[model samples]
Target: MEADPRWIETPDDGELADRLRQGGEAVRAELKKVIIGQDDVVEQVLTSLFAGGNSLIVGVPGLAKTLLIQTLSEVLDLSFNRIQFTPDLMPSDITGTDIIQEDPDTGQRKLVFMKGPLFANIVLADEINRTPPKTQSALLEAMEEKQVTIQGRTYGLSAPFFVLATQNPIELEGTYPLPEAQLDRFMFQINIDYLPEDEELEVIQRTTTVAGEPPQAILSAEAIAGFQHLVRKVPISESVARYAVQLARRTRPGRDDAPDYVRQYVGYGASVRAAQYLVLGGKARALLRGEVNVSFDDVRSLCAPVFRHRILTNFHAESERVTTDDLVKQLLDDVKPPKSGM
Candidate 1:
């Protein structure tokens, strides 16, 4: 990857850039200990982390979606908590509730706020769709605001907090599809698939044998925060930033510039947050690959993951068996970048 000519000169910029690249590679190397494939999945998830955004992982069973996320927390050496969302789960369960407590000396009855699983640095909401919207929304505030309100009191979550949620797409028996508003909160809806034949065989062989050593932690919570702060310093040309905006804008159904397919199949287009994430994700991705500047290719490569969940599809698309991914793909093809920088 070529560093952008517009890159701002900073002291030890190259050294820090190398550290970021090596740190990313280190995480991937550690994941290889148990996880066999899905390099893209790992990359996207890590990008979201660097961008300070949450992700929704979709996959069928036995794909190691949960395992991958759990391994990530270990590799980062961050505090980890896993919540198995179920149909009967309560909102208070995910965000702890206030309970009555009596003091031994004064005999005074008071309510003590108990913290729940959502307070950790890295939270894995496994099978997020399994819970009702009420419970699912309990996490929405924390994901967005980085704090949970209980009994009218707001509690701050530790910095560098990330919610990596997983959903089993095949089973819809008791699943409550996330609301469109909540869906937009996630930076990317990552789809993980079964491994290749050789990778599958390797997984079986590895699992059948004696358990191996766990992945060693590479970056600490402080180091991750440092990278996150550094990501914001990466710059993109105005043309490229406009290209990212146009890419999100074209997803709208009514706009004259929207493609015929989008007008026909899409009910609503992505919000401005889509563009913001596109740019932010691009910066993080650039740094992850050891590049010092954002490129057009960086924004284009993230279109699917960023737009798929933001664009709301209509009945026409569903009836024709068209997916949101199809809409995003068409958006990328039909929307031409600016002749110069875009």
Candidate 2:
């Protein structure tokens, strides 16, 4: 992967961090022109993108989840594609399919592969939960390997490929629940809450008025890809990395360091991927703040989005109206970071 021609190493940490911070501010300013106010949601999405990871956005309808993704696609100068996942959707519909085609003059037939919407740089898997497990499984390979295989033939996707999926939280009657394994593939499960009163009024006022022009592109596809690689190079202290791992470990019910609430409420804890994403996300967050070194605060701020969907809460907690977010906050309170040094 490092040898890929599209990959770029950061020449200067301070200069790159400053550029990233400036770019982030510009992106946010442009996003505000379209989106009313989901600052945290937008930031998390950008963080995951810079970290070269996928995101699963869960929210109620009419919250502009789709619009947010579309706007992001426009601002990043990425090839955009939106797949409306339905019950009857097939795997071939997403990953493309091979079809027979005849030569124009020779009358000889050969198979031709037609690319699907998933081939784009930014793919919006809208209402992803509406599709069955079989169709949903199609994204697993592309999301993990950045490639798809059909009939034992493989095709590489575009650079900086990202899958930003949305799910309706309130309506689950006809929707198929995403498998735990598939859910874990996402780096962050961002919960988009309703807008505040003032923001909602701004939304209404803006919609009622004439539509403004879309935001201009902030970064080219190659630049975005380069930034993704650069984000990985951000320095992280051993103590901060250890703090991330310790936080993930305490979520397990069987671990000796597990908190009392975790054993009582959690049926299963997060996987090692949780720890990995925590550090990666912290690195990205640090970059957007013009800092090259990830701090413990960066990891702590991302815990809810990184671990909320990964950790499984038991029926006892469900009956008690306890949420995974609450459990994660409790875990944060229970686990303290290394005080002085590594």
Candidate 3:
């Protein structure tokens, strides 16, 4: 492992960047002990975490999406709660509800708030699409505001709150597609594919044999929060910032600079949130690589995940077998980054 460059032995230097690289490597190593492959998925999920954003993991069953989130929660040393979303799951069940309570002496009844599963540092919303829109909307506030409002009272969630949700891509029989508004709230729509043949064999061998020890905690919630703050402090040049904005803007079908493919396939362009995540994710990615500044490469690397869910594909694109991912690639190729800083 390459030693981090930012950790100078000095009292005044906080060494936040060095800590981020070390913590990131340690977490990845710990995750590798359990997870066989899907390194890209792991990196993207961690990028979202360090960027202080939520993720929507889409994959088929048996892809270990749930296990990935659980392992991440353990390594990060954060409180983990998994809410298995179902058709019958109600909003109150997710947010929490007040119940009638009786006093023994006074024989008086009063409503007491019962905390639900959303009050953890890391929340795994398993099968998110299995639940109805009403229940899914319950997570909106918790994800965006980092707090839940109940009965006109707001209960702040624990610091370093992250919602890593999983959804089955092949099964839509009884699933409700996430609304655009709710999907936009997620920072990345990560797609987990099948493992390579050798990696799959390794996974099977490990599973058939006796289970090994679980990954130990690597970082605390406080540390994660601090790193998230540090990520925001990482600087990006004006040229890189402009490239990120241009990439996001070109995704809109009606934009003057929109590509021909985008105009034909996309119904609407990516929102401002997409650009925000691109920059934030770039900052996190730069920090993870032990780089001092965000680069255009960092922004380009995250374009697919950041815009995959935000870009809406029209019927023409679907008929032509053109996915949003394809359109994003074309847009990136079409939009050239500025030669120098603006």
Candidate 4:
């Protein structure tokens, strides 16, 4: 298999950096056992994990989105849970609830907190958009705070908790689109497209040939948490950070720095969180590839996944058949990085 383009040679620092890079390579190696292609999607998913954030995977059905996430969790050795979200799915169903159970010896009853699927280290929220907002809101607390509150009591989730949510973009009927607030919590809006004809043929051949073997675990939960900290420590020069911030700020239609396309096509621009994720995701990307520090290219490379969902297009753009990705691409072309090198 061809290596990911971003994993070029670069000097790494410390034992942790070396481990992070090796771990990444090992993961890709293992994932190839069953997965046919989608290297970019896999990279973004790993970047989100290393950055200690969640991701929303958008794709058409039969793309193996669920299988990809399930395989990832297995290879990472994290506890995995899959929740099939529907309109009737309740908050308590996801977050668990306090149930009154009687003690056999004492004959006493009290509310006991029962852990739900959200308690796992890695949660696959399948068809997340199919659920109502009220039920979806249950994840907000756990996703942001790493804890769930039930019956006036909050319980902390296990460390290295990551949610990989998948939604079928083509299936909008009877679906409750995720609210902006919930969408913002996600670190990336990963878009998965059709694989190459060759790869698709290989996928067909493999599935028809034999029962596939599963990927081996590469990193433990504690190690993953440690690598997450290491990613945060990946330094970036202020100029590069400013460039990322400016890029995100320019997405806003009301901002002075926003380009004419943004003003005409977009209803709203990205938020400060967009800038934050750019830096964070860039840092993780840099670390994975053995880059010593974050770069302007790192920030730019993540623009589509980081800003696409955050930037909301207006009616004019929709009518004109323009997408947020189109606007972001134009924005990238117009924006330039600082002259100074780190």
Q: Cα deviation in Å at residue 195, candidate 1?
A: 1.4
Write model 2 residue lDDT over 1-342, tens digit each, in one string. 011232233577666667778778888888989998899999999999999999999998999999999998888778999999999999999999999999999999999999998899999999999999988888988999999889999999999899999999889799999999999999999999989999999999999989997787787777777788788888899999999999999999999878899999999999999999999999999998888789999999999999999999999999999999999988898888888953
Top-down lDDT ranking: 2, 4, 1, 3
What's the TM-score of every candidate structure?
Answer: 0.94, 0.96, 0.94, 0.95
Worst 10 residues of 2 by lDDT: 1-10
Candidate 3 residue lDDT tens string, 1-342: 222324322232247778788888888999998999999999999899999999999999999999999988888778889999999999889889999999999999999999899999999999999999888888988998888888899999998899999999899899999999999999999999999999999999999988998787788777787788888988888889988999999898887878888888999889999999999999999999999888888999999999999999989988999998898888888887777753
What RMSD, rounded to one decimal, does every model reach? 4.8, 3.4, 3.5, 4.2
User: Cα lDDT of all candidates, in order?
Assistant: 0.89, 0.90, 0.88, 0.89
Best by lDDT: 2
| TM-score ranking of the models | 2, 4, 3, 1
Candidate 1 local lDDT, 1-342, one digit each (tens): 222222222357666677778888988998999799899999999999989999999989999998998888888888999999999999889888888999999999998988899989999999999999899888999998999998788999998999999988889897899998899999999999888999999999999999998788777777777788889989899999999999988889889988889889999999999999999999999999999989999999999999989989899999999998987777778787888874
- The lDDT of model 2 is 0.90
Clashing pairs in 1: none
lDDT of 3: 0.88
Residue 282 of model 3, lDDT score: 96
Off by over 4 Å in 2: 1-13
Model 1, TM vs. native: 0.94
